[model samples]
Every structure is written in structure tokens, then in C-alpha cells.
Target: MKDTHKHQGLRNQLVKIISEKGITDKNVLNAIAAVPRHLFMDSGFVDFAYQDKAFPIAADQTISQPYTVAFQTQLLAIKPNQKILEIGTGSGYQTAVLIEIGAKVYTIERQLELFKKTKFFLPKLHYKPKKMVFGDGYKGLPEEAPFDGIIVTAGAPIVPNALLAQLKIGGKLVIPIGDEVQIMTLFVRNSEKDFEKHELGEFRFVPMLKEKN
Candidate 1:
């Protein structure tokens, strides 16, 4: 529960490493520094929390690698107070990063165990999303439509049309698309029927399950 000076020093080293790797977004890097990522992992893995790697958590889910989180977040171009929808809450590390960056986030998780655990855990760290849901990521949060940005943390077979419809004009959706391996993809809503697509690079993520288990 305590974030010691040692933890802070480790986070600074991580920021420097990722910055050299081309993570130029200072806001994203600062958010990464502010969050106590060690608190989101199993105690046995805490020693590696700042290593920019992913580790297994409950429900067979892996907290996304820190570099991956920063990459997706940088693509979003998140602004303070922007309404952002996050798919896949995992260990809530990414959610904490989003909150630290000042986004009003609504996050959903399919795995009930993770959903329940994160819901109970985040607030204790004083990192809270606008809403935490137990539902299908493919469906998204339509009731909170027209988001400024939508970030999908898991890899999807294809981008969901529902997510497209939820984006406001000029908004962005950062998602990874593929099965065995994913191409980190971004879609910017240029108009009601127009989008600009860019494939950033390759990334591997747990598959985004269509239905909640």
C-alpha cells in the first residue's frame, strides 16, 4: 500500500527507458510515473512492476505491458476532462494511468472476477473511472456515446461497428486488430461516415472475448 522513494525512482528509470524507445508524449509518461503500478500486481511479481512487462493477474488475464499502454494512450491524444471509453479493465493499471492523465473514463471488463476485483481495488488507490462495468467489450457503452476517444486494451478480431458509432466526429479509437498477432490500429472519425486508419505496428494482447464469461 505504500509507494516508497525506491518505487518512485524505479518509475523514473522506466520513463527514461520508454522515452528513448520513442514515447514522446510527456503527459502519458508522467501518468505512468504517477501511478503505483506495483500495487496492481501480485506481490511475488512486484519486484518487476517497473520493468515495462506484463504479468499474470486473476482470471488468466495479463496486465498489459507498460509500453503497450503508453502507445495506445499516445494514439488517443487524450485531453484533460475528455470523455474516454476503455475496453478491458484487466488489473486496472491502464485505468489508473487514464485517470492520472485526467480523462473521465468508463471502463468495462468481461471477466467477472477481474471486474469485481478492480471495482473494489481502484478507489482504494484513489484512482476511479467514471463507471466500471461488467459487460462485453464488443458492445461498448452506447449509453455514454459520442466519446472523445475509445481505447480497446485487448486485441479484437475486427473493429466493432458499435464502437465506431459511439465515437464523435474527429474522435479517435485506438485498438489492436488481429488474432494470433495484432496490428496496433487507430481510427479517427473524420465525419459521420468517414474515418482515417493507421496501423502503428505489431502488438500482442489477450483476445477480446465477445461474450462475458
Candidate 2:
């Protein structure tokens, strides 16, 4: 059974944090609240699951902060059953939240160890994504083109053209764009080859690098 109290505590903390930070999307909140974050982190760090902080996992990747997760999801403006693409799977925490929002998710993870670990934990957490690919995130999943929404967990110096090409017209993409410190970016496909870009705010995320393992 879902641990309602523990989950509720996390929800309450998220609401307080987002409200103070000016996040207004209730759907995003609901999704964040629904996913149990402790399941996504190391057992030693499970106690800090609800805190508004990023925590490290394997492969030098860290799960994004609660506010960032909620903020990015809000930017996507997800619709029920929308097909979504996630560039970095990491700990699969964001994917879990995306699934809670009813998105059919296709996530690509470059790190083999992280991918293998998550492949085990994801099913354990009941977050069986539509598809999981182990490949270079820069080259996205070409076979699964035309997504309704796309999210990149890692920060990149410039938005990859390939990822931009995968979005269907009217699709939304929320990514962090920069080399060092990134600004959260929202891209909406305006036409066949045009996009409307919105700079959300400054945020810090691990650099999006090709996985060595």
C-alpha cells in the first residue's frame, strides 16, 4: 500500500516550497505528491526525501530538487496520456512523477550503471515507463519521434537540434540551457520548423555529458 502519511508529508512540503516560489500549477503539485521520492534515493538519504534539495545517486548524477521537478513539469503543461520524452533518466524520479501525471513516457539514459539500476528500481516502484532506452541523450530516440512534450534533466550548453526536431507541432519542451549555470527554458513548437522560446529562470543542474559506462 502507498504510505499515505509519508507521501502526504512530502506533498505538504512541496506545496509550501512551490507556493513560496510562485509555482501555481496544481497538476504539477499532485504529480509530485503522488510519487514517493524515497524510493528513488539511497536508503541513507531517504530521510531527506521531502527536503527541497537535490540528492546524489549513482553515476555522478543527482535527482533534481522538488521545486525544479515541479517547475519543469508545470512548464510542460502536460495533458492526460500525452506522449512525453525525457532525455536523462537519472534516478527515474522525474519519470515516476511524469507517469503519475498520466504521461506515456519514453526516457533515455546514457549511463549504463544508472540505467541498469533504475531498470530494477523502476519496476519496483511501479513506474514502468512506456520505453527505456540506453543511448546517447544528445541523439535522442529518433524512432520515437513526435512527442507531445519533452524534458531534459541535464543541462546543456546549447539545445540539441535533434531534440528540437523530435517535438510535434504544438508540443512543449522544458530544458535547462547553458554550459555552467543554466536557465530553465521552455520551448513550444510554433510550426514545422519554428519554436517559441521562454526563459523561465536561472537554475543549476549537472552538465549533460555522454555517459562513459
Candidate 3:
């Protein structure tokens, strides 16, 4: 749990790398600088944490690659205090990044082991989400309807209509859609019935699975 000076230096290096790769949002980069990326993984692999690559975590999940997180977040154009629903809460790393940039996050994790681990882990780092739920990601949190933005960390075979329905009109849904290799897709709700769609590019992610616990 110790975030040493070495760790901070590594994080700074990571920020520079992602910025060069085209993450222009200052807030996003600042959030990247603020979160201790190394602390998100098992200590043995901490050396690779600042390399902008995805690494394995509990429950057979991989912490998303840094560029992928930054890309999806930059697309959302997060504003302070905006409500954001995150479909997967793998390492709680991305949630921490969102919190750093000032979005109020409500994250759901389907894997019980990772969910439990992250539930206790995030707050230890002092990154608290608005809500952390153990449930199916496909079924967005309807009770907390009308979020300003929604991000799905795992690759969905198809966009979950429930997620789109949960967005406020003018809200954005950033998800990766496909099988094997997912295309980063954005859906912006224009009106109650009109939503705009865009496919940015392809990235690989663990599959979004059904509820098991």
C-alpha cells in the first residue's frame, strides 16, 4: 500500500507516454498522474504497472490497458460531479482514474472475487465510488437511472440496450463492442429516442460475463 517516490516517478512517465499517444485532456492526464498505477496490481508485477499495458488481476480479469482507459474516458469528456456508470470494476483502477478526474462513479463487477477485493481495496487508496455493486453488467443500474455517462470496461458482444436507456438525454455511453477483438463504440443519446453512434477503433478486453455470484 505504500506509494513511494519511485512509484510517483513511474506514474509521471506513464502520463507522458499516454499523452504522446494522444490523450490531450489535462484532467485525464492529471488523474493518470494522481492515481498510483503500481498499487493496483500484485506487488510482484508492480514494475510493469507504469508501462501502459494491461495486466492480469483477480477473477481472470485484466486491468485495462492505460491507453484504452484514457481513450474511452477522453471520449466521454467527463465533467466534475457528473454521474458515470462503469460496467466493470476489475482492479478498481479505472474507477480511481474517473474519481481523480472528478466524476461520481457507480461501478458494477460480475466477478465475486474481484468485486470483493476491489470493494475493500479502492477505499484503502481513498478512491470511493458513488456505488459499487456485485451484479450483471448487461443490466445497468436502473434504480440510479439517467446517468451523464456510462463506460463499459469489458467487451460486449452487443451494446446493452439497458445501458443506453439509462443514459440521460444527451448522455454518452462508451463501450467496446465485438467478439475476439472489440471496437470502441460511443453512443450519445440525442433525445428520448434518438441516439448517435460512433466506432473509434479496436481494442481487446475480457468478455463481459453474466452474474455468477
Candidate 4:
């Protein structure tokens, strides 16, 4: 639907809440404010769009909480026009944020329903990723390797070695690692085989599946 004044106001309030929660990256916050989160969600959940909570979307997946999106994006330290590989396109809300920040995104979605739906839906919102693939994210986009950043939207049991290999030297990978509760993890590629890792705390995300549904 329409992004009304009320929607914008709610977004402003949401931005403030995330900011207070320590999302200091202005670019990330601006992207969050700019996206019409309500439209990305199903109409039934529109009223709670800016509440910083996750809601069920199609394909048995949940659109991530707004705070989680901001937190992961902030960790990426995005720069305009950088190449970003996003695992799990989900509801495409996170894809919209990456596009808003001027990254060239190549996003992968494993669920066939979500892959087709989000592939068609995103362009309607004027958020166009460089490439949208229906494939296993664990494999990553090998042909399009050397990304400036890679974001895994779901919780992984272990970091995918393929993803690490695809990152450009000095690029960053933001992902959550665990099953029941994930620890927000960041990896900075220092060289071909070396990485600097950091654990940013706990979050809950849908499990990252290997095969397409």
C-alpha cells in the first residue's frame, strides 16, 4: 500500500528506538527509515510494522526484527556501490535496506515460494538487487565471488566456508551462528586464509537450510 505520513512517523520512532539501543551507523538507520516496512509485511501485520519485532511471512519464515536488521547492517560498515552477497532473501526487507544504502546486492533465497515471491515483489517497490537467485546459500554465488560484504540473514550452525572464500580481502561477513539462539558473528577477511572474528551477542533467527524447498 501507501507509505503515509503516519507510516513515516512510525518509522521515525522506530529509528529512535534502535538508535537508543546503540545502532550508531547513520547510513543503516537512514536505510531502515526509508524502507516502507509495512509494505514488505503481510497486510495483517502492517499495524505492528515499526515495533522492532519479527513477524511471520510466507514460506514458514519470519521477517527479521527491525533491530536485527539494523544491527547486522551496522556491522557490515557498508560503503556505497560495494558488492554485497546476501544469504536468505526472506521477505526482501533486508534486501531493500541493502539497496537503499547503495550496495549492489546479489541475494540468494532457498525456499522456492519466497524466491519467486520476493523476486517479483521487490522490483515493484523499486528495490532492485543486482541478481536474485533461487539456490542454496551455503554454496553462495561462486561465479560472483570477491564481494565487498556478505550478510547471512538466517542462523547457521557453522560459518559456510564457501562464503568466506567469496569475500574480497578485507571484506566483512555478518552472520548469526547457532540453533536455538544465535550469537551475532562478524568476520573480516584479512587474507586468503586469515580472518578476524568478533561475536556481537545473541539473536534468534530462522535456521539456514542447505537445500531448496
Candidate 5:
């Protein structure tokens, strides 16, 4: 009972921060609140989960800052039961968020170590995806084409065309694009193969490196 109380208290604090920072979607707020951020972080850093900052998990990568995750998720405008494709699973933190919001998530991670780690950890959080691929995220998940939404956690020099191809018409894809500094951009698939883009704002993230399997 004490552990549960601690978890809920931490979640409420995060939700309050998200609200004050203009994260208006109640569903998004609740989803973020529901997922235990501490579970996705290192045990030594569990107390830091509610802070509005990113923390190193493993594999030389860091989980995204809370606001960044909320902002990107808000841009996606996820609806209940929508099919979501996530590129760069990282610590599986974003994946848990998507699942909490009732999305059927399919995630792809290029790094073998992160992929394996996320695969093991995700189920422990009760947020395992519908499908998880250990392959190049630049390729997207072609077998699971026509996803309702796509989110990329890493910064890329340019948006991968393959990811755009996987979006359903009227579907949204949120990604961070640039070399050193990045601008989170939103792409809307308007037709069979056409997409329109809107740049949100500047953000920083680790580069999305392709791993040869």
C-alpha cells in the first residue's frame, strides 16, 4: 500500500507539471500519469522520475525529458485504439506512454542492446507492444504498413521516406529532424503517397544511428 501511494503521488506531481506547461489533453495527461516512469529508469534514479528532465537508462542513451515526450505525444493526437508505430524504442518509456493511451503500439529499435533490454523490461511494466522488431528503424515496419500514427524518438538528418510511406491517409507522423540541433516536425498523410509537413519547434536528441543486424 505504501509503494502504491508513493507511485501515485509521483504521478500526480508529473501531471501537474504537464498541465502547467500547457499539455491540455486530459487523456494524454492521464496516460502519462498512469505509466510508472520509475520503472523505465534506473533503480538508483527512481526518485528522479517526476522531475521534468531526462535521465540515462542504459546503452549510453537517455530517456526524453518529460515535456518533450508530452509535446511529441500531444502532436500525434492519439485516439483510442489507434495503431501506433514507434521508431527508436530507447528505454521503452515512450512505448509505455502510447500503450497507456490505448494505442496498439508496434515498436522498432535498431540497437541490439536497447532492443533486447526494452523487450525484457516492457513486459515487466505490463506495456509490451503488439509487435517489436529488432531492425533498422530507418526502414520503418513495412510489414505493418498503414499505421495510424508514427513517432520517432531520435533526431535524424532528414525524415526517412520509408516512415512516411507507412502512414495511413490522414495519419500523423511526429519526428525530430536535423543534424546537431533538431526541429520536431509533424507530417500528415493526405493521400495514397503524399505528405505535408509542419515544423513544431527546436529540440535536441541523440542521433538515430542505423545498426547493421
Candidate 6:
């Protein structure tokens, strides 16, 4: 409930750390800097908020590392008002970053604990998505199909075809693909049936659960 000068100072240090790690996008950096990440976590873990690492949140989900969030966001190259679909709305941290960067977001979460908490929590921080649903991330959000960019926060055993199909032609899907550990993968829909794929480095994320777990 409090974003003090001390928290802002820590966030600035975090922004510097990630920048040194090679995050060059100013808007992305500003968004990361603007969002009070400490507020998203429990009071006990707030001290770890501005660190360059992920920490546990409710329902066993971990808010993604600052570096990882910045890296995925940098990959998207988002523009203001672009429609973005986010899979795995854990803590709604990444969703807040996207909203800060001015993207219209539609997000889904499978963990009902998080879904319900974040559904209301995000707006309290004045970071609201266009839609937030409690559902499966693997299937993506079909009704809001053809997203300008889709971001999957959790690791997937394989790239879900449904997510690929939901992308607008020329839109990008940034997801981590693998088990145990994941390789960050980006798929850009060039046409109805064609996608350009690039495999970035590795990352670790909670499994993208299916159905209501």
C-alpha cells in the first residue's frame, strides 16, 4: 500500500542492473521503473522486489525476474494501443508493465487464487487490462483472437498451436518452450500458415497448468 522514496530508489538500482544486462528499450525500462514491483508481492518478500531475480508469490507462482520481464518485453517491440494477450497473469506484474507501455492487454490466469486476487489488485494500482479471465493459458484466448502480440509467462512443454493460431498475421508470440528448463522462443506470424521462429536463451518458469488446477 506504500510506494515510498526508498522503493523508488531500489527500483532505479534494479533498472540499472537490467540495463547493464543489455535492455536497451527506453519505454520498456521506464515501464519497469514506473511499476512498483514491491507492491505486487507479500510484505515479507518486499525487500526482494527490486532485486534482479524472481521470488515466490501466492499459489506457488513466482513473479518473473526483472531481467526476464524486460527481455521478453524488449522482444515484443510493443507500440501504444496494440492489442496484447498475456498468458499466465501471475501477480499481474508483466501485465502492469505492458499496460504502462500503453498496450491494450487481455490476460488469462489458470490459478484461481491469483486470478481473483489480481483481477482486482491490478486496477487498485491503476494498471488495468482490457480483460482478465480465469481460464487455461494453453488454449490462449480465442474470442480475443488475432492479438497484435501474445506473451506466455509460464514455461510450456511445447508451443501450443492454439496460441500460434491466435496471433494476427505479422504478430509475435513470445513464450518459453521446454520442460525442466526452458528456451525462450519467439514466433512471428508472417501469414495465415507461416511463422518465423527464433530460439533465444534459456529461462525457468512455473509450468503452464491446464484446466483449473
Q: Using lDDT as the measure, which candidate wins? A: 4
Q: Candidate 3 — which residues are off by over 4 angstroms?
A: none
Of the two candidates 1 and 5, the one with more favorable lDDT, higher being better, is 1
lDDT of 6 by residue, 146-188 (tens): 8999999999998999999999998999999989999999999
Q: Residues 3-63, candidate 5, lDDT per residue (tens digit)? A: 3778888889989998898999887899888888887888888888889998887788889
Better by TM-score, candidate 3 or 2: 3
In Å, residue 131's CA in model 1 sits off its true spot by 0.7
lDDT of 4: 0.96
Q: Which ranges of candidate 2 are over 4 A from the true structure?
A: 1-4, 211-213
Give one digit per residue, the lDDT tens place, for model 1 in 1-213.
Answer: 699999999999999988888899999999998999999999999999999898999998898889999999999999999999999999999999999999999999999989999999999999989999999999999999889999999989999999999999999999999999999999999999999999998999999997735
Give the whole-model CA lDDT for all candidates, comma-separated. 0.94, 0.89, 0.93, 0.96, 0.89, 0.94
Q: How far is 130's C-alpha from truth in model 4 (Å)?
A: 0.2
Which residue pairs in model 3 clash with each other?
none
TM-score of each model, paired residue for residue: 0.98, 0.95, 0.98, 0.99, 0.95, 0.98
Off by over 4 Å in 4: none
Steric overlap count per candidate? 0, 0, 0, 0, 0, 0
lDDT of 2 by residue, 1-213 (tens): 356686787768877787689778877887777788877888889878888899999988899998999889988988889999999999999999899888999999999999899988898878899999998898888898999999999999989889999999999888899987899999999999889999988999999987565
Instruction: Choose 2 or 4, whichever is better by TM-score.
Output: 4
- Give the poorly placed runs of model 6, Cα more than 4 Å off: none
- Model 5: lDDT to the true structure: 0.89
Q: Which residue ranges in model 5 land beyond 4 Å of their true spot?
A: 1-3
